[model samples]
Target: MTRQLVAATKALLVLTLVCGVGYPGAVLLVAQLVPGRAAGQPVLVDGREVGSHLLGQPAGGPGWFQGRPSASDASGELSGGSNLGPSNPDLAAVVADRAASLRAANPDAAAAIPPDALTASASGLDPDISPAYALWQVPRIAKVRGLDESAVRRIVAAHVEDAPLGMLGQPRVNVLALNVALDARTAGEE
Candidate 1:
């Protein structure tokens, strides 16, 4: 019994060290070494860091690009999804309100509202949105920034990232990155 207990204890310690410490350390090392993906791809603006590329944030001003809806608190540590089904009345009301706000903000835009602009993502922390969603806000953003619509559209186009591996997913625009670029451009114009 004593020998058996010793053997079990040794095995448990070895397994714990291997899985908990060694595996995580190895992964971190590899991630840091990867090109264009190190340090979790933090977003920067004008030589200063603003936010991470993995989290969503609120861009309340019309001059900035908006990110996906977030169920997290303002600090963004406690993240969650609303989890309301499509038929849920509360969800429907929220969507309607968002749509109305978008329409009011872009009264002159001829394009139909995109779903991503109105609906919350599943994680509620998605950093990217569909390119269509960004385009939908171009008119409002351009007006607020006092920039030409074509210029805002060009900025959006420049920031649009293709789907991973060319076909693995839909094209997306990283909202935080785009908004940073917008602010930089505005600063340049000043």
Candidate 2:
């Protein structure tokens, strides 16, 4: 019994030191080598931090591009989806309401609203939106910012980031980055 207990204790200590301490330390060292990402890739404006590029946030006003509807109210710490099934009535109602609001805001968007606009991402923290959705808001943003529609479209086009591995996922535009660029452009015109 004593021999077995000693052996088990030794094994536990060794495993804990390697798996818990050594592994995590190595990972932290590796993560630190990559700049900005370890700190959540914050989006800055005029040297001031505005928000994280990796998380969803309100786009401020009609002049800014909006991201997907977030289940956590755009709070990064409380990440989760609504988890409502397709047949759920509440989900349908919420989507309908969101679509209505979007139409009201962007009356010139004649195209069908993209699904990502009405539905929150599975992680409730997606910072990107479909390119179609970003384009849909061009008219409203241009009108609100008093900028030409073509200029706004150009900004959107420039910010469209390709998916990882090229074919792994759909292309998306980061709302925070796009908005920051919009702000910079508008500021430059002043």
Write the residue-wise lDDT of candidate 1 on 53-101 in tens digits: 8778787676788776565632457667788888899999988888888
Residue pairs with colliding backbones in model 1 are: none
- TM-scores for all predictions: 0.89, 0.92
Worst 10 residues of 1 by lDDT: 68-77
The residue ranges of model 2 lying beyond 4 angstroms of the native Cα positions read: 1-5
Q: What is the lDDT for 145 in model 2?
A: 91
Model 1 residue 68 CA deviation in Å: 2.0
The lDDT for every candidate, in the order shown, is: 0.83, 0.92
When superposed on Cα atoms, how far off is each prediction in RMSD? 2.0, 1.6
